[model samples]
Target chain A: MTDYTPYVAAVYGLALLVYGGYTLRWHASYKKLERQLASQSQESP
Target chain B: MNILKKIQPLVGLASLIVLAVGLWYVYQAPADFQQGGAVRILYIHVPSAKMALASYIFLTVASVLYLWKRHEGADILAEAAASVGAAFTVVTLASGSIWGKPMWGTWWAWDARLTSMLVLLILYKGLMVLRHSLDDPVKGARATAILAIVGAVDLPIIHYSVVWWRTLHQPPSLAAGANADIHISGPLLPPLLILSAAFILMGLYMVTVKARQIEASRHLDALEAARLHHDD
Candidate 1:
């Protein structure tokens, strides 16, 4: 059988990129929304 | 009030810990006797593929709920799941292609499973695009829900494609039907299960956070519209 270490590595790395990317994106959106909520409350009050 | 939003931070933390442990388990497992190092990809690939299908199922159920009740909450969930599902499907397709190139001697083929999965991805994109195009939120949500339910027929087709058709992709190993080329055996099973749980936790956290974000944005939009109207 051919050595597939590199392919294996690449797949694992890609998994990190995809999952990590989404997690970061979700956190950013949550932070932005929280800030918006805070500002909106202040403006209304 | 979904309880998930309240514990999003905890969910995120648990996912990280689980992912780390899963990776550790994977490294500790013995290499496949048949596929050698390539079998390591199963730790990531199988979980992703499972999540891709699961997220869509969640989306379909959410869509059905929305259709039945005409609630914004259900629509938000459907929308979030579709977007997350789309991302997972992309991972599934990409990782599968990568795994296939070495194992199958080709990057891709017009296999039934692959083709149906591509269609699911396209439907997800359609859901996202439709979300933005329609100006009225309720109308957009209703229309999208209809589309989701209709498109859901593809789910079973994608799942059973290998059994129903001659496909290069392997059949389900976790359940009975066709034989898989590589079995999740001995030390390998723990890491596979651990990674699956980690992915599921992450998937749940994302959809919950995303649904909350979508609702918050919609509320913000309404407030802005009210302010503009007041100014007028």
Candidate 2:
């Protein structure tokens, strides 16, 4: 029987890492765009 | 009333919850099964493969919409789905290989299922390349739409490859008969379902966000063009 614990941990850890990295990147990009829009709106006024 | 705006945050929260539950299940998995703890890799690998298949389906539908309706949103959705689908395909292959190393005593196989998945990955990459090669947005959309539709022909073959060929990979038990090969107990089933749901939701959220970014970039370009025209 294969000892599955370490492999399982690695798989789940990788998934979490990918998803977390994506979330952080998405949040940062959205925030940067929001800031740009805000500044644009202020300039227009 | 604004459904699209509400989807992202909701999906993000749901994905996090599902991830948590999936981790909990992994922690609880038995240590002495025939496959050992490596069986836990199934949670991520299987779900990602499913997502990859579903993503192609999404691309096909969106491609049809773009061709028939000439809708920019549909075209953008197809493009976004291609990117996510490609990423999921990579994840599926990576997790599968990792699991295979210990179980099958090999890291790679040229079986039909694996080969078809590799083809899908290549097709998706081609679509992305086509999307970037054209300068005109409309032309790029049309070209990629055609590619997406053509690529979807591989999905069914990929799904049935194990059944049709002599292969190292096992046929999908989930589709053959719910309880045929491996029984998913009460504890594991809920989290598996939740994680699958979460991944789909998150995928949709990412696509929408990407589409919005594309739209914003287009708007900025248009504004720049208008300013130059006015100055002229």
Instruction: Point out where model 1 deviates above 4 Å.
Output: B157-182
> What CAPRI class is candidate 2?
medium
TM-score of chain A for candidate 2?
Answer: 0.78
* Error in Å for residue B207 of model 2: 2.2
Candidate 1: CAPRI quality band: medium
What overall lDDT goes with each candidate model?
0.80, 0.71
- lDDT (tens digit, per residue) of candidate 1 on B1-232: 3676678779988998998999899889888777777778777878888898899889989999888988778888898898788888888888877877787667885555566678778889999999789999888898888888877886676657654665444444322211243477887799999999999998988888788788778878888899999899
Q: What is the lDDT of residue A6 in candidate 1?
A: 82
**lDDT by residue for model 2 over B54-161, one digit each (tens)?**
888999999999999998778867877887788788888778777766765567755455556777888889999999899987898898998887767756765576
Interface Cα RMSD for candidate 2?
2.0
TM-score of each: 0.89, 0.82
